[model samples]
Target chain A: MDYHWDWLFFFRETDDGLKYYDWILSGLGWTTLVSLASLALALALGSALGVMRTTPKRWLVAIGDAYVDVFRNIPLIVQLFMWFFVVPELVPDRLGMWMKQDLPYVVIAVVGLGLYTAARIAEQVKAGINSLSRGQRNAGLALGLTEWQTYRHVRLPMAYRIVLPAMTSEAMNIFKNSAVTYAVGILELYFQYKQIIEKTSQVLEITIVVTLAYFALAFLMNRLLAFIERRTRVPGLIVGGKGSN
Target chain B: MSDFDFSVILENWGFLAQGLRYTVQVTITAMLGGILIGTVLALMRLSSLPPLQWFAAGYVNIFRSVPLVQVILAFYLILPMVLQMITGKQMPIGAANSAYFTFTVFEAAYYSEIMRSGIQSVPRGQVAAGYAMGFTYGQTMRLVVLPQAFRNMLPVLLTQTIILFQDVSLVYAIGATDFFGAADKITQRDLRPVEMYTTVAVVYFVICFTLSRLVKLLQSRIAIIR
Candidate 1:
């Protein structure tokens, strides 16, 4: 067998190849959009669930626990497919048809990815909130702040700062998982890569390019998250010291 | 909806069973393959040589960053092309059927990081002790370090197994008739999405739930041993 290396295939002006590359970029755009939307939703839902899990009320804690358990245990693709296929059918007929036909796929993608990631983020937030001293809560109560006020003004901000690093990893995980949306035909980066490979038969070139794109995005995200984490570092906390306080 | 029929699921139980078997097979194969490959990568990353460490690190970073679906797609589409290019012949059906090969290689990149962390978590003092006792570095790693590291890694391994089991479904995109693929075919034919998907979901839940409990038991046992 003979081996020939063709680096120029990636750079050459080929119609099918260029179109495939364009499709991949479009897919990357959708991936980024879905990931950002899901990140927003996860933050909102996760914070509420996290706060509720720490609530003194029995029913709220139970509700929060059940929500986390259901989402955390299920496979993400199952959840995505369920939402995409089963969910629309369960709705009232008019609404169902609208969702199945007119409603945007991106919305469903965001909901699926967001809700799943929220379960994890909730746990991280709960840990972050719990890591603080009981004295802080008592101090807020002692100062005559209402429960909601205290949390809004003091506890949440602190918890958010503490959980930033964990949240960063969770966000990255969610972004990567969002690629599964391509299965439902969302035309995300991976989906585009598949289309490209099928057309040009330049499987290796497309894979290498797409892989590099993913790495660049993830690396940038990590740096951004690290920056946020550093900015929020509690004064006097040992920055890089290991062995857990 | 009353249209949701239990009878359909009951009638299709045999097909579902077949799918479940295939899913389990893929899961087991992928888990074992991934763990073996991941362990080697982990050791490579931990090696004294810079190039090996760099290569392994790059592998992990690239695979981990890309979505698993992309990795699977790459394996399905690219592996065949590359194979044909090198061998001057079409790849074997057996290699194609065993999509677990791709799943395992992809998963290994992630597993290596998991294993590396577990290995690193072992106290340096243990290695020093092993060295003092005249054990070579390889001997110390094999006899002293890895056992302790594996013990520490039980829970993570279990979690990874659960993820791997779920990932087996992605192979369906490439035409492997795993549990999800079977369910998809059934749903397409029977037009009973609710019944078929619910059955599929429950089957997955039970397997994952059982494995999770097993993980907890193993963790407790490891705790006792430590």
Candidate 2:
């Protein structure tokens, strides 16, 4: 068979005649949903771990360090699998049964990607906090503030601001990384891209369209985050938005 | 842990060994190839010429934004078709080759960013000093700037290397029998997804965690105060 271009392949249904383009729109919907949900999880968990790492308690620091190490070094795809296949089996009887039967790929993707990305965010958050003057921590303690209060009242707000630019990159990365959720049978954009190609056999055109779509999403996401970062940036910290890849 | 058995992994050492070999081979080759392409892109990005800068930036942006799996799939699925049309011949690229090419090209975007930041980390006065000493731009960059820059960013580069190693597992998606792929085959065969996945995760953690600690030590050793 000879190669042929089919620009209108997305409009074509599967042999069963399911609406094709709607599949793509739904996939895009899931991708956005998974990314935003995962971002929320990551920011909350990561900031906690970051604060823990800098605390005076030795065990807390170790636990935070171990969490970062365990999550950061593992492949995200593997984590997705663990959450999907293994995690369900480990839960108690009724819940495990329900999970195996009804758990959504988007939920698993959110948890998996959130935990994995949280490690990197923790490091960024820690860096942002460490860059602050030690005097701030001292001031908080001198004011009779507990460690939690110090972190909440004095450290985390400023740290989040300092880390905003780097965090923007992480936010953009999560959206791109959400593509891997397709591995666990999530019908996200990549899965739909592969599905359309498998059905129509127009590999080149479909792949180009998908690639450009991803580029557009990433570009827009970057612009939005950069604007927020610019607004939240401190008066004279030299950490300009030199983006990482 | 109760259901886990070491004998399964022990009996499958040969399979894992083969997978490990491919992993090392792919990682090293891609690291070298990525560094080469990335250095060029970084230089182009930092160049005085506007077109060169824009071209480099655009290339990095596109590649970085696309997920690695999509890029890998595109190469595996799309490139051969384009090659056939251009050459009028059916040239089949195998999974391993496609994985290699994809990782190299995809990773160059990340490495380019690292290299650009590394190069920028060098003090500007060094280049000026090189010029004052009658050195050409190339001589200044090669002799004075890069040495210090590499030292300054060695930890960051090594950190990225760890990240690259973690990402190599994505090769499994294309059925390249790397470390994760081998585990996956056994996992499917034995229906021991948890055990196999745990083993794979532990192996990755050990290798990457140790290397990161070494990088941290090296970072402290070679830190540039300025």
Candidate 3:
């Protein structure tokens, strides 16, 4: 317990002229950017895949299942490595060169994280759809809606509502999972911990600060999502209803 | 541009196999340890005691909020210092050993949540029935409640283990030579990122996908029994 505790170390300027805390703030900025961008991509693609899995067509179901199996089965760090290092070489020469040399690391990190999370979200979406009673779909059909139209107008809206809380959890998950982007050398918050510790050997301080940053971010995200959940709640729905707990 | 050079994989089979063994070892160890500790935490949370509930809730929330990679790194840095203070001796547990400790505690937080739901899923009437039969609370929990709860949670617990299996690869950040780490080492040496990464990805896919299918099968069987 004889270790010297330097609380003011974060205010000290670094070689880049920015204070260490400022550098950490930029890392937090990258983390937020990657998480939000990737979450947007995951929601769009995952909803489509989820709907595909529920369709009557065998081929669409197979495609959806395959996407989940492939993406969900592999560890994310390995996937990030492949996306960063291996994917570029597999493409056409000009496109490969562009991906390798010109594309920002953030885009690759986002795509990798987005694709991986999309698989998990697709499962959630599928579960939400399945949880709805048969009458919901039957009512849509009886109302003269086509299958696609039924999903759009009737099923998806309700399914999304029922699964809002779970989806919110996934939103929180992506924020934490964004830390894995450090593997691809994105300068996110967790990555900054490494950089700072290496530079100053302030391992304990850096770890504590970075951990607190994540805690604060997650707490705020949870509150914001809970507010959104409450604002959009359906009175008789599973999430906000009396029977849920 | 070049042919897929899986020859590197075959050439390094021995090294790769050892690494895969380590991955499986950590997964099994952490899975068992997590569930053990998690069950205790679950019971603590479900207890009527306020202090016990608060402690369990705080542990689960804090662990769940932070990223696993950060926790892994934090433990990697902090465990040695803590160990030194406790033992009054300098003892640096290496990356691989620390991975064991960190994943167990980290996965416990997640496992506790699943177990909590499992416990709650058991009907209150069942507990009442246990009490009517003159069973004490501990006896009722051991004989009646936990068995049913564990059966209900088996598929979910297994699914979590599959996730734990994949997450063990994160130990690479601290330089542990698990399966992915082994592949990474070979890739760095042979400079064949494509072959090494593809092989590792396929290996992970085959194992995890098959386990997921089995879990689904088990779930259906449990549903049938119920």
Candidate 4:
């Protein structure tokens, strides 16, 4: 063996019989919480902005474009640092103190991750909406529905279905992105992994475990979304447009 | 708020440029390495041989599913130790080299997928016709398919490059002074995290936004209008 491998490192007790595995599980909890919270925020804001981007009005589309452009371009770490250090300072004194001192780092991670992923999600949603035939939108309006109602009743459902494949990938992307929350001091999986490495010199063992954990997370998300995508896929919509005939 | 000064940007331009150079260096080097490796991987996945196909599939799945930071970290911290053990000597790889190598391998997975699709986008007829003209499979792909596939995937390749640039920021995890790392150092030094960090964000936004615009323009211009 080129290296000594400790197969039971996760089972090793740190204090009072509490194994290192406990810390990892708790970190997983935080990672899941931040990712789920960010997913919710990204979806809500992304759909709104996505709808705005596809609307007939120029300014609303412009607002949507600007939001995606600004947020998507900035690195998530830089954005998190801004949310952590800059946003608090720009706010009121008490709020600043609260964010600086009291507000949990996980919450800040959620905000940063959510807003950042929202930009990418918005683009996916817009593409989905554009993929739908114009007749769908026209039909809804022709049936005496208002534009919002047409979008809500006709466009969004189909758009969501159309983009579900892309959206699934984005969901996995955000889960992976949540790993960066370590920079903000959230003791997520990566943070726990780092702490473990600091205490134990079993670098390869710990990295393999953590990397597998993330791979499993992403794989499950991809599979689940793919399942949903298959179940919800409209028949005959797969042929797509402008075939090079 | 008024006391927040942007003067630090100019003062630290030299320092920041050094970091920026590393960022650009890694990106360009990794992109070229990735494209070459990824083209091979793409061919593997598309091959009739079961082992090559399976190996390529497994490679893509493993790399794509894991976060890039962890990959970077593994190469940075673990690879050197492994190297030392294998060589029976202390071999301390620089953080920049580790990052560059990791990114090259990591980005290849992504590039493989893009190239796979780009290859698929080229009609079967082209490959068939090449073979019909007495070309070997490699010759067909090299002569007929790849040139068209490259044109087809140009936009996606550039988009991935833009993404590669953003991800270079993560090199800071291993203490490599990429662009974000340099700014981080200034923020720590000047005790002005907000100003320094915001300025860094602005630079990223402007550069990325402008490049994305260029990407869009080029995408439209080269769109294979059938």
Q: Give me the candidate number with maximum DockQ.
A: 3
Could you give candidate 1's per-residue lDDT for residues B1-226 as a string of tens digits?
6577889988988887888788888778878888888988999999999999999998887778887777776777666666888888988544336477787788899788888998999999999999999999899999999888888897998788897888778775676777888888898887888777777777787778778778888888778754
Q: Write the per-residue lDDT of candidate 3 for residues B155-180, one digit (tens) a residue.
A: 99999999999999999889999999
A-chain TM-score per prediction?
0.91, 0.89, 0.95, 0.92
The DockQ of each candidate is: 0.56, 0.60, 0.78, 0.71
lDDT of 1 by residue, A65-136 (tens): 889877877778888888888878787999989988998988988999999989999998898888878887
Candidate order (TM-score) = 3, 4, 2, 1
Give lDDT tens digits, candidate 3, residues A115-139. Answer: 9999989998998898888898899
| Model 1: lDDT of residue B182 | 81
lDDT of 3: 0.91
Q: Model 2, stretches more than 4 Å misplaced?
A: A1-3, A16-19, A91-95, A230-245, B85-87, B224-226
- Across all models, the iRMS values in order are 1.9, 2.1, 1.2, 1.4
Model 4 alpha-carbon drift over 4 Å, by segment: A15-17, A230-245
Tens-digit lDDT track for model 4 on B1-226? 6667768788888988899899999999999999999999999999999999999999998999877877888788887877887888888889988988899999999999999999999999999899999999889999999999989899999999999999999987788999899989988898887777888899899999999999999999999545
Residue A68 miss distance in model 3 (angstroms): 0.8
Residue pairs in candidate 2 whose N, alpha carbon or C atoms collide under 3 angstroms: none
What is the Cα root-mean-square deviation between model 1 and the actual structure? Answer: 2.9
At residue B18, candidate 1 shows an lDDT of 89
Top candidate by lDDT: 3
